[model samples]
Target: METRPLDVLNRGRDKRIVIILKNEKEITGKLQAFDIHLNMWLSDAEVSDSEVTKKYGKLLVRGDNIVCASPE
Candidate 1:
């Protein structure tokens, strides 16, 4: 049997995931929620922009801005 993309993603729920944004920023966080559109909610997120890294307790990412995402 073949696994679908969402099935893989669903298995990653509540786990650490890294997301690359369109602007080239990278974010690593614990996956909280997601939808069919690929919109996501993350907890304890750390965003890395070049040499700068920032932290957020929670973050909401729009699907349109996501370049790639995978479990860490």
Candidate 2:
């Protein structure tokens, strides 16, 4: 069977995932929601980098700013 990216993303809902942004920032969280445009909402989000780590109860990421997403 052939599956599209969205199909994979849909399957990832409510699961832990890592989102990579255009700026090379990485955010890890539970997938809450997503749209055809790739706009996404993540719950219990966290950004971990060389400098520091930030946390959020919820996060909305614009589609244009997203580089890629994968299961955590």
Candidate 3:
């Protein structure tokens, strides 16, 4: 059997996942939607970096800004 990156992501839908950004920021939330480009929409999002953590009711992240995204 084989698995693909998007497959993993699909399974993570509506689940908590961690997204790493190019700026080394981390965002964790329940994934709401995603596209082929990796653009994503998240709910109950928390963005964190070295200094602080911020919360968002909803978030849209560009595919270009993402380094990696994995199930948390």
Among all candidates shown, the one with the greatest lDDT = 3
Q: What is the overall TM-score of model 1 with all chains considered together?
A: 0.91
Each candidate: how many clashes?
A: 0, 0, 0
> Which residues of candidate 1, in runs, are more than 4 Å off?
1-3
Answer with 1 or 3, whichever has the higher lDDT: 3
* C-alpha TM-score for every candidate: 0.91, 0.89, 0.91
Let me know the TM-score candidate 2 reaches against the reference structure: 0.89
Q: How far is candidate 1 from the true structure (C-alpha RMSD, Å)?
A: 1.2
Residue-by-residue lDDT tens digits, candidate 1, 1-71 = 44677677888899999999999999999999999889999999999998999999999989889998988
Q: Indicate the residue-level lDDT of 1 in model 3.
A: 42
Clashes of 1: 0
> Can you write out model 2's per-residue Cα lDDT over 1-72, one digit (the tens) per residue?
536768788788999999888888898999999999988899999987778989999999888888888975
Order the candidate numbers by TM-score, best to worst.
Answer: 3, 1, 2
Worst 10 residues of 1 by lDDT: 1-10
Clashing pairs in 1: none
